[model samples]
Target chain A: MLKNYFKLAIKVLGRRKFFTFVSLFGISFTLMILMLITAFLQTELGSDAPMTEKDNLVYLPAISIKRAVKDTVVERDTSYQEGIMIVDSTVTYPERINSHSRSNPSYYFVNKYGRDVVPAKNYSIYNNSSYDFFLNSKKLTFRALLTDERFWEIYDFSFVEGQAYRKTQVDNGEAIVVLTQKACRQYFGQESGVIGKEVVFEGQTYTVSGVIKDPKSFHVYVNAEAYIPYTNLPPAVLGGTGLMDGFEVVYQAHTPADIPKIKKELEHRANLFEEFRDDYATYNRLEMMSYTFRERYADNLYDEDDDPAQNLKTVQWLLIFLLSLFVILPVLNLVNLNISRIMERSSEIGVRKAFGAHSSNILFQFVFENVILTFIGGLIGFILAIGMIKLINESHVLYETTLGFNFKIFFYSFLICLFFGVLSGLLPAYKMSKVHIVNALKQNQR
Target chain B: MISLQNINKVYRTKTIETLALNEINLEVSEGEFLSIMGPSGCGKSTLLNIIGLIDEPSSGNITIANQTVNGYNSKDMAHFRNEKLGFIFQSFHLINDLSVIDNVELPLLYRKSVSASERRRLAEEALLKVGLKNRMSHFPAQLSGGQKQRVAIARAIVGKPNIILADEPTGNLDSAMGNEIMNILLQLNQEEKTTIVMVTHDESMARKTNRLVRLFDGAQVS
Candidate 1:
């Protein structure tokens, strides 16, 4: 019976070629767009290399401080009856926050509340007034970071040669640097076994401690092309009076469950800063190794205590609303087409009914017919989406990222097919099933 | 055998009430060729539909094959109808999208006990019985009026239902094609012992039936 329905649906759709084309076009185009967006969102927010432990770790994304200062002023007020003048004093303080602070956060704070595990800080090498490097006299300028020695513990950087500079090495303020494989190839013409080589970056001779695969920019904490000591950066860039406030504090949890304790301890320690520095209040953002700046999702994404993926749901929901809107228009179009198409089959329905078909049988037949159509359209859409994704990647429109189909995309496609099938099939099938036998038999004359 | 006790079918609107079947009581015995004759809009087709279980009477007790059917749900009615009744419409009511063989095989497709090959063989036998063996691969649109009606008859008999309910089966055909249809109906009733309830206006066709039932204004007269 299912086979017969499918066979009949194909013939019926083929009978009206133009209608089939229009409906297929609408379905396929909408699905392609949906799939492409989903793939991109996965790249930005999904768990990937270097941040695979993002679900288990948290890092300070950024911080700011806001304060108000009052200045006294005198104003003259005139009161009516006797034309007398009175002097009134008022004080106004406008709120201000310093969004820009020194890149390196205070090491003193980390050493205070910090446990035995990972603690690291990075300075932006992209802001290179401090150092200029000549790579084979090609004058290559690239973004880099100067991080604490334990930065390697928080980030899962896969190395090609040697390993990160040690905590003892960092404590002694040694000039050691880690170079990405890309940087090593450009500077040394080789990627492996360059641990003892000395290279000059930013007017300082630094020993090459490691060579690693370049991290995707999604891992903002470790996306740099090179890393050196904060001590090696000119002292001018590292100047903050009270505790060297400003770089990200990177920490790894002992286990996935330890994230909350670490966050609470960090929050408490941040709150304590108010007691020591009277006028300052703390306002900082966190991006867990388990989460990214882009996909700061709900707390439950990692099955953890706090929501490290902040405001991500709002963005995700907005995307859903837009996709639904796209889906709805095409579904409405398909519904209209289905109505006209099924109207032609009213006599067939009446005949079926007369042959002992229940209303439910008629309903299932119609729904099955439409579901088959939408699923076919969905398959077409999936193929087109894959093609579109390939085209987008080749076009370099979304640079530094390659998008493709995966299990998540495949699952979403399946759901879209079902959603499209049910969404477009219901009203038409219901309408077809409700067809009065008498009227339907009469319509057979046409 | 079938019995309809005190059946009434009313088509009501906001301001008008039209009785299509009025307090009708009927009995169709097994293997009887009963022809219902009436003028247009006189409830002949409505009565046929109700008897076939395609349309429910407003108030009635319908018993088919010695089991009460009034309480049967739509699904139950459908199953009983498939097992015990078949239908032929005035337009032949063939699915134009399907081939004649596929059209003939339609009834058996709903039966879970019948496999695909069995359905094909049964459909082939039915098509041969209707003298459309050579045209089995042709679509309804490709067949002549008489050929289409034969295909429909083949569809009706494919399941070997105990009763065949044909509504103006030959109304759209010429006199020659109509004779061919009447002959087929006569042969099925006389030779195969299939009971038939047909609604028609042709006086000659009515005379050939074992018994004639005439209705006027939604009520049975004779």
Candidate 2:
């Protein structure tokens, strides 16, 4: 029964040359679009990232604080009446000093006995500045890491010429630099040549001890092309006297399953700070790796008032919806075409039915034909999608990002083709199978 | 052998009802050559469709080969048709894309009793019997009208059905070609002793059969 149905189906298809071409063309066209969309989504989700241990890595954004000063004067009349003469008065304020008391004061006053007076000089002071001030301060600059050497153990950054900084390097205050491939090319004209060379940054020269691979992870900040010893942060940064006064502490869990416990522990640690206890306490937030992209780049992406995580989630959803639209429309169009073509074979179906073909047999034959056509189309579409992705990657569309060919995308597109082919063929197959032999034959005769 | 007892077939539409077959009773014995003759729209082809188990009677009992088939479902009827009957149509109804041999082997593909190679051999023998052995590799479109009908006749006999049903099998051919096709049918019945039933509007074609049944307004007249 199966053989007869397939034989008849092939014969009927061969007989109607124009209809077969149209139907196959429609299916192939839809498959191409679906394949392209699958490739794009896969690349966006970091499926092409070369690192084998991506899930274990975490990125931390450093935070700091510094005090800033602004001066203002006010004038007031002592006398109640406007016409009354008022005695003139002048006030003096002392200059600011560090809380450590070892740092020099910007201003001071000497009394008649040659002792410094508290209010002799007219200088105003402010204290208890937050992390943002330190980060933006021009007077003090340092590379402040709130983490230790454990960070290197989590991420596998490739070294072209030299090794990663050792734990002792952090402890001994070694001023070493790890240059990314891009940075190496920019500074020394070659990735290997950058090793042992010195590059000047912020009026200081640091030896490029190693050339590291570019960070391919989507979540990492692109600007962190250089690594400095975490423990070597200057005394001014450690004592809250420099631009790096605030420390953005990050710790990685041993595995993804430990993230929740780690997050809870960090929150408990942040609550112990006294400065974060009052109304200002709401500003303190601890997040996991999932939120790092938003937490780190929120300010640069949107207005300070907008929620960064919400924006990213919205964009992700929009992309998914757009991709689905690109896939579903062509699939539906092909499905309609398939149904119409099947309808045109109603007479052939009736003849087959009269010849002892069961509904299952008929359904199988139709589905088999569709699967064959779709499989061929899928192969062509996959090749086309790969070329398209390569072309788009080389173009300026996604600047600074690479779209590598991904097997997962190809497999996903193939699965999509199979699913849609079966789903689209169902209605037509059912309708074709149920064709009444008598009526169909009579209609054909007419 | 075939028998129909008071069969009625009515076609209904939203605004009209037409009876294509009404109160028909007929029987043809095994090994007999029978012909059904009538004007167009007189239900001659409808009667053949019913006898072939391709159409259902609105109200009646049909018995083929001494077995009642009136209440048989589609699957059972299809089995009955494949095993008990073969059909040749006025248009030949050959799948034009397939070579002549493939077209002849179609019915045997539905039957599980024959292997593919055996069926092919049998189809080749049937085509040889129909004098079209040289044309086995040629597609239906590549054959002349009489040759196409001969291929259709070979296909009908390939399954070794007990009864052969031909509906105006020579209507598309010239008189000489028509006579050639009629001679093939007569030879099959006389030599193979297979039961043959045919429908035609041509009286001379009807007269060639061993027995003639005439129908007017869906009922048998003689």
Candidate 3:
């Protein structure tokens, strides 16, 4: 029975070429857009590449310092006392002055307060910046991260050539660098054979010790084209007293279960360091917080004035609204088209009913037909989405980022198509199935 | 093989009630070929719909093949219709998307006991009986009015039902094609002893049947 229905459905789709085209256009286009968005979200936010093992890591990305100062204000009362050349009374009150500063945590702040406080298996402190290098009298800028040898252990960089610098090399402040594939091509005009080659940046020459794959563009914390040792940074950059900010920290716990303990310890350290004195000045209050990958991204969405939890909720609601709209609008369009299309076959429905088809059978047939349509449309959308992803990668719209299609994305797209099919097909199928036989038969005469 | 007791079908709207079939009481014997003659909107099709179990009478008790079917649920009615009755419509009512053979196989598709191969064999046999075996793959649009009605007859007999109900089977055909369809009905009645109840307006067609009943304004006259 199902086989017959499937055969009939294919024939019907072919019979009405214009209607089929219109329906397929709406379905395929909607699914393609959704697939593209899903691919982007997966690449940017999903567990892939260097951050694959990020579940057990906590990051301290910023430092917030607040202070309140007391100033004396004097109020005098004079009039009749002035006539006698004497003051009657003088009052002094303390005025409150509040100031707050927030930025990426400095190396000095992380080393002095954050290092011993968090109970973790390992940790790394890194500073992110960009530097200009002269190549044949042409200046090119590349993003760079300066860190210790422990950074390599914490990060899972895929090296294509050679290997990362050793602990001894970092400690001795050796002028060595690790270049990403993109950076290697830019500096040496070749992907391989770049290891052990020297590149000059701002009058300083460094040999490339390794060539690694470029990190995704959205990984702002670790997406550097060039990686060098922190010990090699200039004295001025390393001389920060907490006010100067360029560094961040990542702590790797023995297991993800130890995250709460680490957060608690960091909270205690923040409380203990409430009043901090540095070369810049003294702060009356300080807040040092740790975040998981999701929380870190959410934290970046708002400023210090906005509540992070509330911001996350708002963002979540917005995303749900957008996705629902994306699905609902196309579903509604398909439903309308299907109703009109099915209504044109009322005579067929009447004939089927008269020939022993139950209402449920009719319903099943229509829904099955719709599911088939959606699957076809989904296939077209999948091919189109892959082509779009390739185009985006080739065009470098995301700048060194390459989005990919994976099994997870494919599974999700399949569900979306199924959901779309059922949602759009149900109402029209039910309406047509319940049509009175006499009325349906009469439709042919009109 | 078919019986109806005081069947009443009333169509109601907000401010009007129209009687489509009024107190219709009739019985058809085994292998009896009966024809109903009526004017337009005179309840011929309405009565046929009720008898075929496609429309429910407002107040009636229906019996077919010695079993009371008025109280049967939708599924039971459908199963009973598939097992005991076949239908042919004036417009042929064939699904235009399907081939002629597929249309003939429509009734058997609802029968769970019929395998796909058996259905194809039965459909081919029915088409052979109708003398349209060569046009099995052609769609309804490719066939003439007479050929379309012949395909409808093939579909009606594909399930080998005990009774066949046809509404204006040759209403759209010419005198020659009409005679051809009437001859097919006659042949089926004589050879297979299949009970047939057909609704028509032609006196010549009615005269050829074993029994004739006339209707005027929702009531049977003779």
Candidate 4:
């Protein structure tokens, strides 16, 4: 029975080539956009290689400090009734409330609280900066990630030549750096045998200790061309008094189950800063927050006062709303088109009804036909999305990010096709199914 | 066997009410080939629709094959119709997208018990019976008027239902093709003893049937 429906659906779609094209165009275009977004999100948010242990990792990107300051207001009233100074008064009110500052945590703070107080299997502090240099008489810019030796343990970067710098090299403040494949190609115009070559940046020359694959844009923390030890930075900048700026911290838990314990301990360590500092009397409260990659992404949209976990829900709802809006507009158009298209089949419906088809039978047949149409459109969209992804990658629009399809993306796209198919097809199928047999036959007569 | 008591079908609008089938009382015996003749808009098709269970009368009790179908829900009525009744229409009503064999297989598609091979076999058998076995792969659009009607007849009988209700089955064909279709119906009635009720306008066709019913202006005249 289903085979029969499938065969008929193909023939019917071919009957009106223009209508089929319009419907397919609508369906395929909508699906392509959805697929591209899904691929992007999967790349950015899914636990792919180099960050495979992302579930057990937490980021301490910023430190927020709140202090209350006194604000004085003076008011003078000189309102008189009948030329009399009946209401002449001066008053001053002093209020202390609401002042906050936020920035990346300092290395000093991480050494005091992060390494000793925080509970974690491993911790790494890193800072990102960019430098420009004249290479081959042309100016070029390269982003640098300065970190301790433990940063390598926290992030598993794929090395193409040589190996990461050791703790001894970092501790001795050796002028050594690792370059990404892209940086190596740009500087040496080659991929290998340049590990010991010296590259000059900002009047300082450093020996290349290693070379690695270029990180994609989705690798937020690791997305840089050059990597150097944090000791290379000035001591004054690393030992800032206010613990309110300079470095970002990442902790690796022993297991995913230990994430909550590590977060609790980090929170406890942050709370201790108030008691440990002599300037405790200057602030009303002291608090610090840490988040996983997703929460940190969500936190980017919120202020220091907003809880990222709570805001995550809001962000999710917003995304869902936008996606639904994107999908529903096309669906409404498809529904209208399907109604007109199916109207031409009223005689077939009448004949089916007369031949023992229940309303449900008719409904399934039409919906099935529509699903077949959608699947065909979806297949086209899949091919289009792949082409678009390839084009985007080749165009260098996202820089190093190379978007590609995976099994998960394919599965999600399949689901999207089904969702698009059923949602657009149900109402029209139901409407046509409920059409009275006599009325449908009348439609045939006309 | 089919019975109808006090069957009434009214078409109502904002200010007018038209009676399509008024106080229709009918009974069709098993294996009896009955013909209903009437002028245009005189309720022949309406009565046929009601008898086929495709349209519900405003008020009526219908019993077919010892089962009262008056209170049957849509699903139950559909099942009853599938099991006991077949329909043939004036326009052939063959799905244009489907081949003649597929069209003949339409009624059996709803029968879950009929497997795919069985459906194909039965459809082939029905086409052979209609002398269109050679045109099994031809679609409705490729066939002549006579061939289309034969395909429609093959479809009507493929399920082997006890009662066949045809609405102007030969109205669109010429005298030769119409006589050819009438002969098929006569053969089915005599050989298989399958009860048949057909709506027609030809006096010769009506005379060929075992019984005749005449209606005028939504009422039985004879």
Candidate 5:
């Protein structure tokens, strides 16, 4: 019975060549668009990375007075346009004074009689232009704690020749620079071979100890041209200049299961610091590197102020919506064609009924017919999707991005096609199955 | 054998109620050749449809082969139709995309009582009986009207159905072709002893059957 239904279905489809082509084309186009969108989303979201252990790495920024302040008021003296003035106002005093001070000022500056008072004397207020000059002159530095050697354990990076910065390198205060392959090829020409050479950074020449692999996380600072020893950084950076110095400490949890425990311990340790001893600095604010790509990268995309991750999220949603619209429109077209085809076969259905075919047999036959057509369409759509991806890749709209047809996207497209085929064919099949044999026969007579 | 008791089929719309078959009671014995003759809208085809188990009577009991089939669901009806009955339509109803032999083998495909090879052999034999063995590979569109009707007859008898229900099987053919198809039906009835029930408007076609039943305005004429 099933074989007969299939044969009849094929015959019906063959008879209406134009209509069959239209339905197949509609299904193929929809599936192709859907596949392309899925591929684009997968590439943009960095879901293609092989790093399964990134969830445990937490990016810990050093708690300082800078990040805690609500408003940083720098009182400018109108007396002498560019000259300095010592503002005695409480609002601007802390900011102006803290801006010039390092993490541990006692180590660098001695108390010269009354000139350099321990805490109060270190505070200096300058006029607008002088303050600007002072702020500009002060070098910005970053500090991080490499608590575990496992910090480099979770990511995949290929070393051109040497290895990553070892625990011994950090313990010995050896200032070694780890150059990413891109950075190496950029600074020293492709054939320059700078693996064991000396490189200059921040007025200091550091020996090229090892060339570590480039980090694959999209949010990782790819421009870290040189990585010096954590211990070799000046005391000023280690302690943080003022409260706003760009000092961060990163810790790698042994496993993802230990992230909560590590976060809690780190927060407890941060609360013990003198600056955050009071309720001023909130302690438990650990940011994960994985989440930065998801949440923080949006603000960094176009403008430094806007989060790039949010933009990516919005774009993802827009692409999804567009894909859905594309799929739905074509499916609607197919559905319309299917209904018309069913109408044309009404007499055939009546004859089949007059021959004692059951309703389910009719329904199954029509659905199977539609699925066969859709399966063929799906193959064509997959080919089209690959072509589209190749075109997009060649266009380079996604600069520095790689997009291709992956298995997940293919599976998704196949499922979408099957769903579309059934949804589009069901109503028409039902209607055709219910065709009245008497009316059909009488109509044929006329 | 088939029997219909007080069969009434009414087609109802929101604003109108059209009666297609009213209180219809019919019976056809084994090896009987019956014809229901009527003009258009006279319920001849409707009565054939009800007897064929393609349409249900609004109020009546239909018994076939001593089994009550009035309330048979779709599956039961399909089983009965595939196993015990075959249909031939006025338009020949051969699938245009299928060749003559494939069309003949359709009923056997549904019945599944025979292997594919056996079905093909039986279909070829049936087509030869209808004098279309030479046109086995020709599609319905390539065949003449009489040839198409003959292929439809081959399909109707290929399953060895006890009853063949033909709805104006020769309506679209010329008188000569109509007589040819009627002769084939007569041969099947006389030789194979197949019960035949047919609906036709032609008086001469009605006379070829053993019994002629007349219908008018969805009712049987006394």
Candidate 6:
């Protein structure tokens, strides 16, 4: 019975060339867009590579301090009528500074403090510009992170050779550096085991201590060209070491199940620290490293309760709602086309009814037929989606972020096609099923 | 094989009520071949639909094969139609996508007692009986009008229904093709004793049946 229905459905769909083409075009295009976005999402947010232990790591990417309001007058040089003049402006703002703190501070690893370790992003400045050095006569300049041995406890870095700067080296302010695989090649004539080799930076020489694979561009939050101890960077260049801006504390939980307890403990630490701090300092935060990508990239500008985790959930639901809207429009188009199709098949349907096809049978047959159509369309969409993903990747829109097809995508596309098929076929099939058989047959005679 | 008492079919709208089949009381004995003749809009087809259980009579009591079908639900009626009755139409009503054998196999699909193999075997037998066994693989579009009607007839009897309801089975065919269809119908009635209720406008064809019921303006004339 189902075989006959399929035979008839395929024939009928082929007979109406324009209708079939229009329906397929709509369905395939909609699915293709959805697949492309899904692939990109999987690549961006999927827990892969360096983010593998994302579940067990909590990151304090930013700290907001609600300090006493301070009014300060700052002089700015402004040009008026082709002449430079000094102007004084009064600025009132909270001392909620992360990258810069007025009070003295110390590194978490050095102080043996804060219940966790921290890796600080350090930008070497020379004459108001990022510092660079000549290596093999080519200028090499890359962002760097300054940290101690405990930094390795919270991170999972795969080293090709040597190791991170040791605690002794960090404390001794030794001139040692860890370079990424790409950096090692750049500074050491493409050599892999160039550990202990010296690289020049800003007229100063630092020995390479380790080499690791360069993180992909998507791992921008923690990615850097080199790593060194904060103590190596003269104190003034670090914008005041420890508990300062550009430094985010990463708490390595024993297991993901202990995260809630860790968060509570973090809050307790913040409160305890606040008791001894200048009457204005305030603090609260511990976001999962995986969920904090957006906030981290945005320089952790999110306010309390606007944590990236909550923001991510809202964004996910919004994307789903938007994608569903895309699905609904094409569904309505297919339904309208199916309804029009009924005009030609009414007699066949009426005959089937007269021969004992119940309304339910009619409904099921129609929906099944439509599902077959959508399934075919989905295949086309899968191909088109691959093409689109390749195009986006080549365009470098997301910096070599790939959107390749995989088993999960295949499953998703299948369901999307089936959903569109049934959603579109329901109303039209129901309407035709309810038509009086006599009337339907009567129309067929005409 | 079939009994319809006080059958009435009416079409109602906001402004008008049209009688399609009124006080239609008839009985078709087992193995009987009966034809109902009428002019256009005489409600012969409507009465056929009501008897076939495709349309509900406004008021009527129907019994077929000793089963009280007056209050049968839509599901039951559909099952009854599939098991106990078959239908043929003026346009032949062949599903154009399918081959002749597949068209014949339609009724057997609803019968749980028949396996797929049995359905195929029975469909082949019906096609052979209709003298179109060689054309079993040909779609309806490739067949002649006469061949299409033969396929329809094969479909009607493939389920081995005791009663068959046909409406202008050869109406679209020429006189020669029409004669061919009549001969096949006559052969079924004679050899299998299959009861038949047919609606037509041709008096000559009506005379050939065991009995004729004539209708005018939704009412029986004789």
Q: Score candidate 1 by lDDT.
A: 0.75
What is each predicted model's overall lDDT from 0 to 1? 0.75, 0.65, 0.85, 0.85, 0.67, 0.75
TM-score of each: 0.81, 0.77, 0.92, 0.89, 0.74, 0.83
Model 5 chain A: weakest 10-residue lDDT segment is A125-134
Inter-residue clash pairs, candidate 1: A54-A289, A54-A290, A55-A290, A104-A247, A105-A247, A296-A309, A297-A309
Predicted candidate 4 versus true structure: per-residue lDDT over A1-446, tens digit per residue: 99999999999899979878988887788777877777777667766656776788888888766776667666667777888886565666676658766678777787677774345788888887888999989999999999889888877889998899889988898999999998999999998789889999999999999999877655768788899998898878776665766688888988878888887887777666664357545566555678887787776666443587787777777778987776788788888888887888898898898888999999999889888988898888888888898998899887787776775666676677678777677888899899988889878552
Predicted candidate 3 versus true structure: per-residue lDDT over A363-428, tens digit per residue: 988999998998888888788888898999899898767788775677676688778787788889
Of models 2 and 3, which has the larger DockQ? 3
iRMSD computed for candidate 6:
1.6
Collision pairs in model 2: A64-A131, A64-A246, A65-A134, A65-A246, A66-A134
TM-score leaderboard ranking: 3, 4, 6, 1, 2, 5
True contacts kept of 1: 0.66
Scanning candidate 2 chain A in windows of ten residues, the lowest lDDT window is A105-114
Which model is ahead, 2 or 6, in terms of TM-score? 6
Q: What lDDT tens digits, residue by residue, belong to model 6 across residues A219-297?
A: 5444677777767666665544334334445556667676666656555555444333543335332222222344343
Q: Kindly report the docking quality category of candidate 1.
A: medium
Residue pairs in collision within model 3: none
**Interface RMSD measured for model 1:** 1.5
- Those runs of model 3 whose alpha carbons end farther than 4 Å from true positions after fitting are A67-99, A274-283, A301-313
lDDT of 6 by residue, B1-222 (tens): 888899888999999999988898999899998999889999998888888888888998999899989888889999999998989888888888778888899988778888989999999999999999999999998999999999999999999998999998878888899889999999999999999998988888888999999899999988
Which stretches of candidate 6 lie above 4 Å from their native place?
Answer: A17-19, A22-32, A67-141, A182-198, A237-243, A271-310, A381-396, A400-406, A409-413, A444-446
Superposition error at B63 for model 2 (Å):
0.5
lDDT of 5 by residue, A1-446 (tens): 55655666677777788987887788788887777777865664453443343444443322223332345666554444357655444344242212211231121111111122112111111000000111135533321222223334444455667666767876686767666665566556562367679765556566776675544333332224445555565666444423333333333455556655654554444333454335334432211222233333442343222233466577556656877788888878877888887776666667666565677767887888888888888888888888988988778776435576887778878888898888889988887777666665554332
CAPRI-style class, candidate 5:
acceptable
Model 1: residues with Cα > 4 Å off, grouped in runs = A26-31, A67-141, A160-163, A167-177, A181-211, A238-240, A243-246, A271-310, A323-336, A444-446, B2-6, B23-27, B60-63
Q: After superposition, how far is residue A236 of candidate 3 from its true place, in Å?
A: 3.2
Clashes of 2: 5
| Better model by TM-score: candidate 1 vs candidate 5 | 1
RMSD of each: 7.0, 14.1, 7.2, 5.1, 12.4, 9.7
